[model samples]
Target chain A: MAIFSLWVINKAGGLVYQRNFADGLAQLTSNEHLVLAGTLHGIHAITSRLSPIGASSGAQVIEGESFKMTIFLTATGTKFVLFTSLHETTTDSVLQRVYEAYADAVMKNPFHTPEMPIRSEGFDSRITALIGTGQS
Target chain B: MTIYSLYIFDRHCTCVYYQDWHRTKRPKPAVEGGILPAVSHAITPQPLPADSNAGSTFTSPRNTLTSTSGVVIAVNEPISPGPGLYQTPPSHQQTQANPPPSTSGLAFDEEAKLVYGVILSLRNMIKRISGRDEQFTNYRTSTYKLHLYETLSGYKFVMLSDPNTDSLRFVLRQIYNGPFLDFVVRNPLVIMDSKERGIDNEYFRANTDRLVKGLSVFP
Candidate 1:
């Protein structure tokens, strides 16, 4: 399965980063990325707040079937979202790999600002390597 | 005169320079406490000479120092033993001891500032798109975040992600801090309010970092 894109939303549901890897998905305007981030954040907050203590921690929060989105938290309390096509149940693993890549490339780089677009050379290279590895 | 000294004992390099503009000598303003000893001691920022424009191909401000002193101390800094809490205080102290020179105004020209501003804004944009938090190593954090994205079309759009409200603020502070702060803000070459649009990602990618270094200013 090919992963298509990624989006990150702050705890407050603001859109932080959005990128698409493939060309099939319909393009969205820059404003739309912001709106989409806010919308997803809103949805995530509602889901978390509504869930009972037991249900919130373990279950995969699903927004729709068209695309699958998974969120993971880091040791330092940051949320990462990985958006993939509608074919997977084991997205947590892929998302984890992306997180590792982010930690190494984006977070570690002095120039990288948290919750922003991916611009580090290391990031692009690592992502390309990971995606390429997955393809083969 | 430019004076260079090499400390054989400490293996440090020291340089100092001073120039007299011979303009009206205004009295230095007294500042409270130890906030800004250097600025408090300096003369007023005079307008550039009538013959020299800001962006002209001349010596940069760093090159034209009125009075400057620099000593590169070659201290044998100890490597940290581990990722422990014990090392945090000293690391912070080190940062305080040697503040990073501003990397923004290297070119020191009108267009250079504009270019540098664009680079700073782009870097900020990349940071935003990467979903990283912004830390102003200078002081406390600013309350708002400016989000920008450049599409493949070579256009750039910025959004204000205010923490206190829902309304979006579409101002580019980096650009404001850049050369076009006065020109771009007042001139009609740009649009401030747009819902969201496609932009030239390549154009930004090509020029941003170059601009960042060009507009950097050193103390």
Candidate 2:
């Protein structure tokens, strides 16, 4: 039931926003973060391309020792990645809430410059609150 | 439903446009002068490592070579000279012109700079963290909300409203897709990089004003 972090990646494979909630993960340098995002994007693309049935959407989950990652891609190509405990099964609802928050706070904001990193306090607070409530 | 102001900054971190409305107290005149410089300083991009692969993907084709170097020289002078449209009077001048009213205005300027700096740093940090291109939408404080809408070419539209104000990102996008693209970005008469520091087209202003005012919650 513990959520570690959330990340939003744009169509071009650039990370737009990321927030950490639980604190056990090792910290990464900025360049490492970029590399990680690019790698994930590449892997996602490759996974879709190599799908046995044909080019499907993308990878949905990556289970690790410490946490499990769930990825959801929007029709518009935006990707939402959530890292949570292995026991958490409600990742879909979390992603849905995150998408709604993105649309309401980020998409609806007039000052959000396109293709830049997200810095919306409203979005941050909303997501944090969501995770907090979910954990409790 | 008080809308304090709006500011538009280019990717280069230049405060190209600003306007304030329905505020009882305004920042001091000196405070206004520091905004652009502070924003520019706050937005100064960190030099990327030579081996950085992220740099290649992060760079946009629309950004000119000079902009990448981060030393922006105004290529064209702002077309309009009318101070009426550009200048905002100092709030303290209405009360006392002598010893400079208390530090509230200066404090406000610092707060504004802090907010802008937070936005810029958060943007950069997100890029590093996510390893993908992303855009910020809006931020809300206890007392105020800051909404941002950015174009692909890196033009930023910003608005500050009361905390309870509904979404204004659509309005910003409309302004961008409509009057901004049609009149300023597309129109040859308007120079985005000029010292004039605003979209001087009357048609753009008029239409944008109409759009902003048309918002249901706007005071």
Candidate 3:
């Protein structure tokens, strides 16, 4: 599982965080990022409301032939996204581990604000360590 | 016959007048021309019925003067300033826009400070409602670089970054307009007014664009 980027959107659809990993995406302006955050937040909210209870939240964990966008929940009701793109691999364990890492590194960080951008150095170091160790 | 009337003019310049005509007559005819006394007296100031005051209290603070035909004037005198519950800081050209050497020389450090200040301010705003501080520890080490620029109209924009994250720098601009500007500036409780203290808006707006462009993800 390779996490390509992350984004945080407030309840009001404002983008609080946006990041890209593994590098294939085009660059976007800060304003564009904000707009994307807002739009994604809106879509997530609508998806949640339309979800059938006792089922997973409408956030999709798609494992296409080439890429995936996994949306999961943070403790403060914000979303954590980890995107991965690969030609061939089993993504189940990668996605789950990524979620766990996020819970530990980002959500549990006392310095992290809900619905705000993730900025903790510890979170970054831990993720790099995890991905680095696995790569070797 | 003479009549006094209340007339309403329409948008198309048509006038609709409501009138009660009167004729001077013998005292015996007083009962027959009963409308004059009642109408004239009603036209003069009299205590209105209790229900009249119930609807609304929007008083027009202007005196209406009737001049020649098709002419009307509403003169609204300027209101005197209220007592000094709040004092306004004198207006001046902002120095932060062109900050002195002490400020501009440390532009890099200033950008970092802006990020920290903004984050702390945001956290405080949220904490006012959330009442929790658990997230503070994780957010502390995040590093940011900022750049600022001023538009020709004197508005400022700021670009902000957190280097460890893959996200690009974000930009913020002043979206507030007139009355809201007054609310923040004229408010006595605001310790740093935009015009006087020059810290809040000038710093943030001026460097937004530069900050956004300067963002670089660190290894």
What TM-score goes with each of the models?
0.35, 0.45, 0.32
The TM-score, computed over Cα atoms with residue i paired to residue i, of candidate 3 is 0.32
Native contacts conserved, per model: 0.00, 0.00, 0.00
Model 3, residue B186: distance off in Å is 70
DockQ of each: 0.02, 0.03, 0.02
Residue B198 displacement in candidate 3 (angstroms): 61
- Which stretches in model 3 have alpha-carbon errors above 4 Å? A1-3, A8-14, A48-56, A62-66, A86-92, A132-136, B1-219
RMSD of 3: 28.1
For every candidate, the chain B TM-score is 0.20, 0.60, 0.18
Candidate 3, residues B108-180, lDDT tens digits: the string is: 1121232233333333322321233311111111122222222334333332223234212122223223221
Interface RMSD score of candidate 3: 29.9
Clashes of each: 30, 25, 26
What CA root-mean-square deviation does each model show from the true structure? 21.7, 19.8, 28.1
Tell me how far the alpha carbon of residue B69 in candidate 3 is from the true structure, in angstroms, after superposition.
61
Docking class of 1: incorrect
Which candidate leads the pack in lDDT? 2
What candidate 2 gets wrong by more than 4 Å, as runs, is A5-136, B30-102, B107-115, B195-197
Candidate 2 chain A weakest lDDT stretch, 10 residues: A46-55
